[model samples]
Target: MHDIAKVTLQNEMDLILAHKRSMRLAELAGLSLSAQTTFATAVSEVARTCLESGKVSYLILCVNTDQRDKFIVACLKNEQLNSNRSREGLEHAKKLVNKYNIFTSGTETAIELFYYIAPHFRVDLEKINEWRQLFRNEPSISPYEELKRKNEQLQDLSEKIQKSEAHYKTLTNSLPLTIFSLDVEGKLLYANEWLERYTGHTIDYLNNSQWKTIIHEEEYATFAVLLNKVITQGTATIKTQARLKNKQGDYIWHQVSLSPFRNEQGDLQYWIGFIVDIHAQKVVEETLKDNIELKNTQAKLKENQRTLEKYVDELNRSNLELQQFAFVASHDLQEPVRKLLFYSDYMVSNYSGVIDEKGLGFLSSMRSASHRMRNLIQDLLLFSQINKERLNFTDVNLNEIAQEACQDLEIAIEEKKAVINMSGFPVIAGDASMLRQLFENIIANAIKYSRPTQAPVVDITCKQNAGFVEIAFKDNGIGFDEKYIPQMFRLFQRLHDRTAVEGTGLGLAICRKIVEMHHGTIWANGQEGEGATFFVSLPLNTPGN
Candidate 1:
């Protein structure tokens, strides 16, 4: 590299220095007048861009040689990365120069413009140093002449700026979007032709109203707030969406973005904003939102179903364990209970003669206690089996069920002298054995809880209503308080004294389990001292149906 001259670009005068140095270097290298002017103008364009950034920059004019060619180069460099503000000027300079290159490293930017030196020109290091010495020793011009030169340069720069501004205006007007600018006080500085065409308002009107007339009334307040916030702060970039009314009196969605344009010193100059149509994108987003919600709802339902299936599997496993327990209780436990009852009965029958009256009474109590224990074990086995096995449904005559239940409890009914009244019946879909158990437990309860003063009477009646077979068992027995209704169907929830009623307290519980398995309902209605009526409603169709 052979040094020609270097100038610091701080003001308009520095631009002149760069321009003059570029022309003098080209002339010393034997360039024609036209080429000198072109090179000078290109260097001036780049220098002006650097100066406009409101920061100090350097313009270095030098001659560089490569293996293949020798060249004169003008390189403009800045310490700050403000290349975006200099893009237009750089592009203009590129058209005038033979070759140009731009580079950035960290916060610095360098734009190098090159012109090839003709091979025939015998330029050497000694001649380049002489040119440099001439510039250093050159006499200063008179103050008047310097001022006149500055005015001519300023006039030429103003003409170039006007032409650039006209070119940008035409380019923006040809585009499909609305481009705008605003001052720090929210005053309209400039608006493109697209804005005027879309809003059907001239730039003069927009300047007076600040384009607020074209924004939808519903969003005007929000838009105003955003504009005011950006103007007040003058340091942030904000983006928002609103309905902008078109010339056809239709409001369409548009996205608006505003950015603060600042100088190198970080002072706010103006707000640059753009508006683009986004009605189609907004519609798609809304549609996707609804689809997302629907998918979420479906996902929740599937999750709930999976959870329910998990619970059902656990219930099935628990029932299987209970079934195994029932097997053990019936076989292992019943044998010992049977032996106890047998020995107690044998003691009473064989030793009554040897035993005194008090001893006989003790033996009799033992026999009775063993009998109660046997009944309790049997009831427990029945309770465990209900949930363990699946129902076997068939067409069952409820009349026959009632009759079979009565026969099963004939001994107890005979002992109580209970009167059983039969009424019309209906054939329904149910598990025959479970339905029989349900009836038998209800009848036995009626016979056991009969008032000591009256003979027990049970009337069994059935009728078809809706899709169900409704059966009512009206018993003239000692009724219970209605408030205990919730507890009446629970296991081991006895309402009467053990001495008064010989019960295992599991009869009603087993009945309820059977009714539930068949998808039927059972409830009792009665008051104290009044006879109770138990109503069972079984669906006519199968349980699953």
Candidate 2:
């Protein structure tokens, strides 16, 4: 009983394997049948065969392929039956396939078998063929039809764009100012009809040729340079004056404003600009400038005339005061000297023997004082009259003038043993006589002050400046304190004792006045016991020198 049970389990295993092989073979053959029906049929047949065979323990069928098509294997408990079943089933199926012209295979086991339908016959061939034929008969549209529809839509869009462009052009042309654009290469790209109408050039000519030729010759090169710079810098706005041609072929001054247009990437696409005629404004500005200049000139002339009249009146008043001063000084100065001279002559002639030595000495002193008083009065008169008269200026060489002054003072210079050094004096415009007098007074002072020195040296030198000449008179002598320089130039302000320096103390005062009258200045610098230098700065060409 145990052995019989083991054989029964083996037979059941064979049937299950055979059924699995049949399903696998069908799948491999690409069968389109429902899995439920195929599985039920294969399993039921295998079960019935297994129950009838008591000797069979188990059976199984397996499928294999060798290039062309699928084949099946059957396993059975009876060795003979299992070996012949596959052959017999294969032959029977082959006959069926050959008779029906179908590509298929089938086999069996002791309790089970398998049958396979090739891909060509396993599926629903009639339905598949009908689908393929229907696909072949389908219709297609022509390429031109689709393209024509797209073209129609594009044409509509193009028409709208053209209308919008025309409207923009109309608005731009209606503007009062001339508007135009230039390409990146500075060639005229687009211009409104207003430009052609105003400039007397057709749109074709303006766009094809260089716009610079239409610009005035004087402004063409400048405009080209500026426009090129604007493009190179990517964008710029420039206001420049240019001469633009009008419809009548005449040039008109225009103020042009050029603003560059650029793309989103900051590349210069073109320049847009406007031109406005400014000839009327320019003419008005020029006329106003001329009128203002004329008014300023007239005002200046009037002011100058007023100043001249005031100067003339001042000169007359100064002359009158000078004459009065001279007269009063001469009269008051001569009275005391006349009495002293008369008394001195009477005392000397009548009491000559009776008077003692001291009395005689007193009379001699009186006579000397009288003579000095007369000389002082004469010098005062000369000083007052020096600049009271009119000045006559001419080219006067001071070298020659200084030589003459030296000659005039030859005797005094000789007596004092004064050595004068003079060189390189400039020829200046001045009154010859006044210049001669000026040199005489300064040279005489130098000689008188140098009396105490063993070798009296007076050096005279002249240096030329931008508008004046600086003359230096330096003397090596008994110099005074620098503190007394200001007082020295004042009348009757003597620095030395009366007995030491014999003069009315009026010589320097006269020198100052003479220099000032010639529009010059005089000052002195000195240190005690060293020397004194007088500096005179005279204008090179003063009206009265």
Candidate 3:
């Protein structure tokens, strides 16, 4: 096995060396000759050597001219002729002769033997020379002529590009906005014709530091900062107001926008920006604003005058009504009280011994009812008067007011076993007495309605927001439906049956009125089975006070 491996290695080496020598001889033959006679002789010699060495079985040579005006030549072979070495040798020699340009038509062997000495013989050599001369005399262009034509086309394209760029500049300069470009270092690079016209200067003058010099000194710093930022960020746009020197040498307001232009590499090469004349727009806007402000002021003055007149009329009417109501209440209520006293006195004095227990009970009930009627009339008078008066505005501590109100209703709260939870509250500017009444009414309602519950709980909490304070009173009592909420705050409006609850229904209405007068709002949220929470948001300060 080792001996066989050595023989195989030696055979491979011999084959590679033989192929290299053949390629070298082909290269030498291709360079040294151009005419067919010498070219054929060179190739035939290499073929003959290959055949004698038995390296090549069958050989064929081919040659042609490429587009580059250079020759391309190759050799081909058949390995099957290795079985008949003599035939392979003869075929290889004939194949080389067939490559001769003069011997164009023959079998491989005939052309090889004929062309070998025919070049030196008069008959074959004379004919080929005549054909070569005829072909050489024909007119034709060289490969260099084709490349020259392509270069002329490229030159024409470059001229068209330059003309298009000139047309683009003409269009850009015709715009109304002043267009300009600057390098990253704030040097003026390009300015449109409109800029020159606006500044009453030439393009050369505008391209220098003249543009910067024309910017108002007050805006220069800000403009510089923004310009630098635009370049640093690679791309940016900003609209800013600046004062620019016009042709008349007067400063005019202009709206300028600067934006960075970047190349494909994302590097900011320059900034392109525009400036528009905004003096007219700016003046119009300022005038409009001033006019609107003046109109608002005049309207407010007129409204105030009208409001004062209405208030005066309302006050006069209230005074007259109060006077009439006072007269009727004093005379009518006194007459009923006097009749009841007189009758009680008469019954006790004249029929004391004759009166039975049932008759005495009836007399007592008559007196009690009459006295309750008198108290109700007095409460009604007070309610009417409260509406007629104006609120007394001052900074009032709502927490303290709530505490005081609860103390006044302490007996009722304790007897009903009602729990009142009062928490954080804010100091609000309002009439102290009205706030007290507001708390009193809500708390009293909570206690009164909670009588049926096993453990009555009333939670009072307050929260102060940006412009108002919210005081919530939640009660676990007989709650009313949400649909009745709109009517709940109307005077004399009642949700529960009169026989079930004892109230004139004036309390909530008064609470709402007081809150509204303070420029605040009040609402109730509850379900039928659950309890109710009344939210009152009162402004910290009263309006028009």
Each model's lDDT? 0.85, 0.68, 0.65
lDDT of 1 by residue, 1-545 (tens): 77677777777767766787788888887889999999899989888888888776898898886436778899889876366758888888899988998899877889899987784656777777898888666554557436644675688799999999999999989889999987777777798988878889987786678567889888887678555744457458888889998899999999988888889999988889999999999987887888978789889999999999999999999878887889988899899889988887888778889999999898888888888888999999988878525688889988898889999999999988999999968888888999999999999998899999999999988888889888898998999999999999999999989998899999999989998888889999997788899988889988567
The segments of candidate 1 whose C-alpha lies over 4 angstroms from its true place after superposition are 1-317
- Superposed by TM-score, candidate 3 places the C-alpha of residue 106 at a distance from the truth, in angstroms, of 99
Query: Global CA lDDT of candidate 1, please?
Result: 0.85
Worst 10 residues of 2 by lDDT: 1-10
Candidate 2 C-alpha lDDT tens digits along 333-417: 6888888889889989998999999989988988988888887887788788876456788888989999999999999889988
C-alpha TM-scores of all predictions: 0.45, 0.40, 0.40
Quote the lDDT for 167 in model 3: 83
lDDT of 3 by residue, 25-119 (tens): 23432333333444444444434443544443333322222222223232423222223543554455446443322222222221122222222
On lDDT, the candidate that comes out on top is: 1
